[model samples]
Target: MALSTNCWKYLVLTFNALFAMSAVVMFGVSGFLLYRLFVYRHFIGVNVEYPAILLLMMAIITCSVAWIGWRTAKSMHHFHIVLTGVLIFLVVAVQFSCFVWAMVVWDSVDIDIKNSMTSFFDVANEVNNPNSPESIRWDRLHVQKGSVPFSCCGQGPLDAKFKPYTADCSTLYQRGCAKPLHQYTRQQLLMVAMAALISSVLQK
Candidate 1:
């Protein structure tokens, strides 16, 4: 059956809107990540990961979709509509999943940091109290640094006592309080891989 001109125009317009939105979202997210990696070098680190690569891939896919949509606008076709629809759905799903995973990891890190902080404070208060039992002090000496530092009690010039104050600080806090942040970043990298997988599946 021959497609009506009005029907074809509507299809092309819809495709254009969908692809354009996808392209903008992908580009914006990828660019933001890249900018963060560059500007906040310590936060994102120098090493590349699967998530970073996947974000880049998503940006490329979105651009491709935009291009195809533009072409379709010039010459609408049934096949183009089907292709665009499938691509839009797949890309959107992947993007949404990646975003959700990122948020989850981000929140996990926050909770971990908060818990670590609470533990550090409890140990610290025990250590600071003069009337506290010698046993409590002994126990506090064994506290290792946690993933995030509640206070710089065991860092810098004070770190000299970290070995003796092990109970007051977690190994994570002692070694470098940024370890959990690094883990959070690594999880973000995994999200990029997820996005890449989606892009690959969509390409198929």
Candidate 2:
């Protein structure tokens, strides 16, 4: 049986509200990711921020469209509803592009991350001379970040011993930073998929 127009409108409104909440979450997470990237660019690699910026842009757009969807749901104006649909279509396209880009990045992120870590590892290994650049940077990171070395990432992994002229996997974290990065990206993709699925369901 066909749902009454009012019922359909209410249902769409609910979906829009949920999607707006998702946008809020995405905005907050993306903003935090951007800050982390800025602070740890040396170790994380500067290029990683490109996708984050795009995600932020998409979050902003989604917020605006969700607001429009809310208004359309209430007014149920034919033209406005059509406009909202178009907006959703655009968002879906953007989400697809993001998902694809994320997948591509995911494929090679480990290699890229390991390459970036190599330099930092060298610095950690050479952290004996107080005046040396590597020592200074290494000390600054440990003192400033206060994260578990080899066990933590973001800004760079800290070695457990922190002894000068020494490096070993025994003290370094076994799990690579790529795992968390991949997890976060996968979450973002899942959110996009959920939004698209919700929109499709609402249309029916």
RMSD of each: 12.7, 8.2
Residue 138 in candidate 1 has what lDDT? 28
Across 3-106, the per-residue lDDT of candidate 2 in tens digits comes to 69878998989989887887787778767766756565555565555666676787889889999999999988999989988988787677666656655665
For residue 129, what is the lDDT in candidate 2?
60
User: What is the clash count of model 1?
Assistant: 17
Deviating ranges (above 4 Å) for candidate 2: 1-3, 110-135, 141-204
What TM-score would each prediction reach against the true structure? 0.44, 0.56
Candidate 1: lDDT of 97? 61
Give candidate 2's whole-model lDDT: 0.64
Counted clashes in each candidate structure: 17, 2
Could you say which candidate leads in TM-score? 2
